[model samples]
Target: MAERDTTGAEGAGTEAPPDRKRMRSAARLGAVQALYQMEMTGATLKGAEVEFESRWLGAEIEGEQYHAADVKFFRRLLRAAVDRQAEIDQLTDAALVERWPLGRIDPTLRALFRAAGAELLALPTPPKVAINEFVEVAKAFFDAGKEARFVNGVLDHVARAAKPAAFPA
Candidate 1:
């Protein structure tokens, strides 16, 4: 349950980007933040999903298209992650060193890892693609080199441990 202030005025709208890739990137980042909020507050997945949609997708962000497809995709992804969090956490814990249990990691990083890991394990996409997308999301919110490297490394480790068959050759 992240606090919602809605204090700032909405920016003027710009031309929508024709590229779906950019839209997907924005959706993924939205999903990550929603997952992080749910993790921090112990909110139900549905509650978090609605909050994210109302705040990010519902808000009139300049130059962005909050397509229904993107909202649905993000909601599905976040719900899946929350529903299967225990299994995902177990996989993540096994991939990490004993001292670095997921609970001990920064909450934001832990949530990001769980969300990415859940997608990698449960989604139909190739594991490498999921990892790459999540790494890009990490880079946007964190230091590009260090955070992306960390996300990539941990995800690689988790993929190897939990879904070796899905790992790229």
Candidate 2:
């Protein structure tokens, strides 16, 4: 989600309040990116978290501006993904078909799953909302609809397992 900087040249315009939904969506995107950075670069949780917060969040990169993220929500998602990593990975593995395990998946997809799994396990977000949000994330990274559909199916299974009460018999 790209939100342009709204301030005028002299910073005289009245900037609108941040949209809560967009901020949270940006947070999800940031968390996934941070996790992917950690996985690829061997960055520590604190290091990755700080780097994303300071350098990436709301920063224009490659000429595209990013939306301001919900910092607290971003931190929570990143921490949950790192802290409960083994558990999240286990849940993801269980959700995937036998031929494709968690480790064998694309790194970006893996990161997205970890962030989404953490939210499913630790946050109060409704499972469907989490699923939809992450499906959108998958769409952001993948050009084809196939990857988005794959993310949707896997996250759906993970959500059902993580929050059974949300999906009653």
Candidate 3:
């Protein structure tokens, strides 16, 4: 894993923006992009992992200094999502209408869905929160109404079918 540049200067005397939520959303968006690149290029898992770190660093430097905890949390979330991808894809496919294979979906959307669904099913976070976060990410990069709604609906189905135990009470 690439080390975060902890030596970087902190924003002196400046209160952090209230945009941490958006930044976190953007990080997950970045992870989806990395996953899409990996799938399209047929890169190995290690290659994809390295690419994620590199891209994340670039994003951080271009953006602001994200809290280390948030950065670390996203990295863990992305890895867990990648690790359980096959199972997550299987579950997602099963939930789809007419057995839509992941490859048949738009690659970007597929990656986003897989990443989101993997977190929903495998991570210890609440399902509704995961779905909402990913929906926000999708909205940032795509048409919010139709595409975002599609993502939300499919992921909701996956959450119910794949890992009902993780669903919100």
Alpha-carbon runs more than 4 Å astray in model 1: 1-18, 58-69
Q: What are the lDDT scores of the predictions, listed in order?
A: 0.71, 0.88, 0.69
Rate residue 76 of model 1 by lDDT: 58
lDDT score for residue 55 of model 2: 94
Candidate 2, superposed: residue stretches over 4 Å from native = 1-18
Query: Which should have the higher TM-score, number 1 or number 2?
Result: 2
What is the Å distance of residue 152 in model 1 from its true position?
0.4
**Alpha-carbon lDDT of model 3:** 0.69
Stretches of candidate 3 above 4 Å error?
1-20, 56-69, 166-169
In the range 18-69, model 2's lDDT, one tens digit per residue, is 4877888899999999999999999999999899999999999999999999
lDDT of 1 at 79: 73
Worst 10 residues of 1 by lDDT: 5-14
Ranking of predictions according to lDDT: 2, 1, 3
Best-matching candidate per TM-score? 2
Candidate 3 at residue 67, lDDT?
Answer: 32
lDDT of 2: 0.88
TM-scores for candidates 1 onward, in order: 0.77, 0.89, 0.72
